[model samples]
Target chain A: MNIFASLSRKPWIWSFVAAFVVWIATILFTGGTSAIGLSQAALTFAAFSILVGIGQMFVITLGPGNIDLCVPATMTLAGTIALKFMQVDNSLILPGLVVAVAIGAVVGMGNFALIKLLQIPPIIATLSMSFIVQSTAIWTNRGLRIKPPQALAKFTTETTIGIPHVALVALVLSVFAFILLQKTVYGRWIAAIGQSNRAARMAGIPVDGTRFVTYILCAVLAAFCGYLLASFSGGAALNMGSEYLLMSIAVVVIGGTAVAGGNSNVAGIWGASLFMFLVVSMLNTYGAGAGIRLIMTGLIIIAVIVAAGGRNPNQR
Target chain B: MKRALPSDSIRLLIPALSLTILLIAVFYLQPRAMSYVGLNLLFNLAVPIALATIAQMLIMTVNDLDLSMGTFVSFVACVAATFLQATPVIGVLILVAAIATYAALGVLIHVRTLPSIVVTLGMSFVWGGLAVLILPAPGGHAPEWARAVMISRPPLVPMAIIACVVIAMVAHFVIMRSSIGVILRGVGGNARSVERAGWSILGARAATYALAAFFAILAGISLVGLTTSADANIALRYTLLSIAGVILGGGEFTGGRVSPIGAVIGALTLTLAGSFLSFLRISPDWQIGAQGAILIVVLGLRLLLNRLENREKRS
Candidate 1:
């Protein structure tokens, strides 16, 4: 009873409910005759949402009024590097994944260094980084598409017992992330750092190193998700990762994670992801094109954020 | 007679240096492209972006950023096109109406004290949708007379360049002299302080938004004439470019100082950069990459400079 009451009081709960209602309405009105394909699509969207949401959650965990703007570029660069490597040699799939993760780590480290060294605000630094990443990706691709290898594609496509393979990957990643964030000493430190960074440093926590690692981990997760997305679609495009930017932020907000940091709810994110997928599906069924879909998504996010209020009234 | 550097004078130099470097590079590379006609093209191109950059700077001054300025420009342009394709007079009216509508929307958003990032983003989508609904495929031209007046070259100098100079001068005067201008700078520097001083922060923010929307409309008008047609993607580039210009011009995210002349110089620099890239016959992909790279470098430099300045102050 206490758990239920506590969950109910969460600001994200209302958004989750709203998203669920919209999703159910979409499924019912659309008539789920093509259940297999729809289910596959829903699963894939849900999985990617979790991956991106986790990245957002990590940044929020640092608190100190921080947000990352380089998420889309980070995801794109990860996927692009993975695809480029896979193209060069068919056997380099695992190695390519490692390279992508390394790239994400470097990006994370660079972001942390810039923020700490120059006193550039986190948002501005991340934003500038995003531009650099996007520009670099465009230059590398040379207006051409890079397709993933057959085996990687199969991994994303092949279903186990009717569920999509990508969906399974998302589930595994989420569970791992949930455990790491909840049961680990690192998780406790994240909570502490978010609540009060100065105090955490005084308490002997490696605040800078911890922040650096969390951002890198976030980027790595996003990269992994990007690889899945690229593999699923068979290739990557210039603007392929742009859609995920807002979606990631929306999921985190909807999942009962305070934007100000120090607190998070994985279950809430999971629920929100599910609801968001349904809403998108419904909007698609109603004959809404990409432009309208984007508009509706933006409006919905704003509405949710407004309901949650800005940056928690109590936090300084 | 030696005089101390006015606070605004140093602010103006940043853009001047950027513009000078860009122009020198262009002229050095392709003197042929520096014709009167080319100069006109540069000025025309800079107008919309300059207006939009000023708009972005205005909101940013209050510690808010509008990611939707581009979409608003597209919306106004498309709506005006729908009405003006047949009658240019009606098109001007439609443009005015669209601007007024967006301004009202901006006021409402400010009243709610909602995060401008999300609100403007959502508004961008709404405006983009409306634009697409009005012109699904981006056809329908502006009147020849409208285009002629906009694109015309004067005997001594390009009319477009003259118009830009005039606008910059007027904006500089108003920014330095107006009561609202002073309040805007105060609010940008510290909104909480102003609110505590018993000023209506909401009203000030709304007025700033109104000013931004007004400039967005002017940008739209210039853009519609330049392309001679309306398209959904027209506004997308301006959003990022405007931010780049504002930051390049030394406009802080927190409001206190404004440099309209600085923004113009930033706009000119951007225009020259684009022209220089084109003269080199670089692929469109490389041009975009270059733009992004330049912005990042500038921002990094700005941060480094600020840090050095802070250290100097402490010492």
Candidate 2:
């Protein structure tokens, strides 16, 4: 494909360019090796968002106006629960993972029930679920401190081929997501449903069931991200998952995933997540306060929304 | 394809029943809550939440969600607490500007067909960042006159309850009883039809959002008056709280089917539920979950009612 054709077809290209531009900007500001160091650290730290962003991208792919707001709370719940179970014995790490994932599934089920049975809107259904899940996290743990298992922590921290294990895990997940979305019948179903759910239903697709599975998949991924992040950070806190609430959605949007749904860009999510992380890091390095950083992030999100052509006549 | 009466009544009935049940439960659980002081304490925070819910309801009337409502309210409170204290003129100008910005956002949303969620989500950070920049910390006194008006007591009714009643009445009259209200609801129910009828959909949406901003600023001012100080995060929870309030009150996302009185009642129900849980000595951690549980169960029951009503109609 020619450059214009590819640019028009591949939405992720924008994120790739944005990430590159930000990287260059960082290098110009910080001088060479230091910028590299910042990039390495940001990439490693951004793995969690990458995982969450990809999951969000999948759900958004399911349809326009569909979203999952429970990811943040689910992640927090999973992180705290994982630490709680693992604190007793490092040998219980596998069990801990299972429990966290189970909890996430349960939350997803609750969201599905609300959205499907009650016919509640996705935002409200998941938001209400988040409140419930977050409350459970707070009630059960009461802000207790528990250490992550030593082995897992070491794996997350250690570098192989100069890349962190967590980052590698994220990369593997991205590849898997790419293949799943680009090469599978399920991906085609999602695309069709996203374009027109009524039409897809008329065509014999199991629209509701597919959406149910997508929600569950999204939640599970978030739970896994939480587990990795908690272990890397040594522990978890109440607000640990708060930032992800908006960041996940922002990354998916910035990564070139259509907000109205029907498209998936796992690679774009990866690049967008890194770009977001670097934006924050760059602001921090410049001694910018939290307020300024927040303002910049908000502005960037708005800019991306406009660039995405939210009012595309075809979709409307 | 007839719009049956039973289903519509059932929709209204559920919220009314839920509010009654909640009120009875709260009173049964805590008998002393019947007194004037008890009522005052129970409803001290309800005014701002109710106001915010009204704001949310207006936007929903236009089929848009204002994700930034909480931060925008907090931003107003920051202005009330700081700039209003330092110089009244500049503070007033800033607020007017913010409301105008909200109107501009409505135009942008309508023109670009951007999802309100994305635009408001992005604006949330902008509003929150502005609030943080204004106060930097949580310490700022509300202007004296505003505080006086907020704290003033009326005979026979608690000030909070009175404020809630007045707000509900005015909003109900404006949005439900007036011709403009009909036009606004028309836009939400069927924008194409409204546009075909030659009504300026853009103007209606912009006006609706401006009204939302107006109510949000009022909520912020009231909040500041009550709390006596403001911070960027003070009203952060109001976003979800207001959404819950509107939904509990019988508002739908796509329809202009919202009730002003129901919104106030819903806000009160939630407030009372929270107070009752605290009275029961449930941990703060559990209180949020309990509220969410209440919301789900109530909404679930409404769903069941709707299905049954529909089935009956079909039969």
Candidate 3:
């Protein structure tokens, strides 16, 4: 009864219901004609969306001001770094992953420092940092494309049984992140600080450090997703990360995570990710190109935000 | 009795200093870059963005963002270009109609009390899509007379500079003298308090957004003149640039304060910066990176100055 009540209380459950309806509509319309192909596409997009959503959730649940504009750039920079490293030496695959994650951490730390030291508003600071990171990525790439490494490519493509590799990776990461957020002391601190930094500080929580770590963790995860993205897309482009910005925020909102921080629903986030993918896939299947797809996506996000209310209770 | 300078006065001074420093840097680096012709070009480039930034600043002062300004601008430009291809008068009518329609939409969203960011962003996408539909490949041209009027300079000074000054003065008047302006600042500072005072938050927000759309339309027309042709992609850069300008000009995104003149000056600074980079023959990619870097640095410096001022006052 308690579990059911909790599930019912989850805001993202409503989003999931919406997603399920769309999934059913998609399946009915397609009539199993391209079931395997549809599933593959859906899985890949869902995984990518989930990873990005997870990163957003962390920042939304942490930060003095509950907003993050650096997710896309951080992800892109990480991907760019990973790709560049892999291109130079095939033996540096593991090192490349570490370096990519580290780059994300550095970017997050940079934002954290700015917010803490300079007292720049969170949204503005993150936004400016995002621009910087994006520019850096563009500059590093020298207005050219960087191909994905072969080993990483194989890892992302190789699947076991019926499940896709990307989906599996997403699942593992989500579960791990969920556990980290729910069961750990740091998780409790995150929630506490998010609720009231003053109270958290009174309770002896390292508020600034926690926020810094949260941002770093978020950036690292986003970067990891970017790596996965590069592997899937086979190459990294300059504006590759920009698309993820809105999608990630939308997923977080749909997943029942408020932008103001404190509350989070990992399961709901995963469901939202799946729902977003299903919607996009359905739209694409119906012959909607990039422009239409973008418009529809924007509309759906707006609708969801309206339904959820303008201010998230958890937001600072 | 001793009194500290008003916040507004300090706000004005910062932008003035920033602009002066920017001009000095440009002149020092390249002495010949300060020609009348070059200044005219800079004014032309800054005017549209300055108008858009003013619009953005109004919304931001109310603690709202208008992400759709660029798209709205593009849509209006496309409409004006298509309907007024041969007649400048028709183009003016189309522009007014477009602005009115967008303002009505703004009112609708405000009345609903929806999140401005999400609503405007969605609206922008819809408008952008419509623009693409209107001019699929960007071949249609604005009437030659209209274009000439938009880009032409007066005998004594550039028309663009005059437009900037006139618009800034009008905006300053509207923001400082009007009851609606006071109400906007009040609402931006604290909506709950304003509501408690029996004021309609929606009314204030709607008016600001409508004003923003009006400016956006004017900007769109100017952009059409600059490019000669209506392209769907023309206004995309304006979205970020306007916000950057507003912030750099000491306009807070969360409602309460605005500096229209500051915003214009910020726009001018951005234009000058871009031109200076172009003069150095920097690639497009490098230019973007440099612009981003400069904005971040400027914002950082602004924050540092604000902190110091606050501390000094406290002391």
Chain B TM-score of model 3, please? 0.90
User: Which digits, one per residue and each the tens of the lDDT, describe model 2 over residues A1-316?
Assistant: 5978766667777777777777787777777768757767878978989998888888888876588989988998999998898884779889989988898788888889889988887877888888899899897678786789898788878888878888999999999888888898887888889888999999999999889988988999999988888888888777788889888988887787777778667878887888888877777777889889888877777877777655344653
lDDT of 2 by residue, B119-208 (tens): 899899999988989989889999998788778887879999999999999999989899889889999899999999999999999999
- lDDT agreement of model 3 with the native: 0.77
| Per-residue error (Å), model 3, residue A148 | 2.8
lDDT of 3 by residue, B7-38 (tens): 88888777777778777877777787577676
Error of 3 at A24 (Å): 2.0
In model 3, which regions exceed 4 Å deviation?
A: A1-8, A63-66, A88-90, A289-292, A310-316, B1-3, B84-113, B143-146, B280-285
Sorting all predicted structures by TM-score, with the top scorer first, yields: 2, 3, 1
Model 1, span B158-199: residue lDDT tens: 877887787688667666678878777788788789889888
Residue lDDT tens for model 3, A1-316: 9998886666777778878777777777888677777777777788988998887888887733466778888877888878888884558778888988889888888888877876767776787788778878877887567777677788788778878899999999889888988999888888887787788999999988888888788888888888888777887766777867767876786777655567777887877787788877878778887668767866776676666654334332
Per-residue lDDT tens digits for candidate 1, residues A1-316, read 9998886677667766876677666667768665567666777778888888888788877884466777888878888878998894669889988878887887787677766765566765676677677777777766567888888888888889988787787788778878988999898889889998989999999888888888788777777777778877888777888877767876776676765578877777777787678767878888898777767866776676566654345532
Better of 1 and 2 by TM-score: 2
DockQ preference between candidates 1 and 3, better one: 3
Candidate that beats the other on lDDT, 1 or 2, i.e. the better one: 2
Q: Deviation in angstroms for A26 in model 3?
A: 2.2
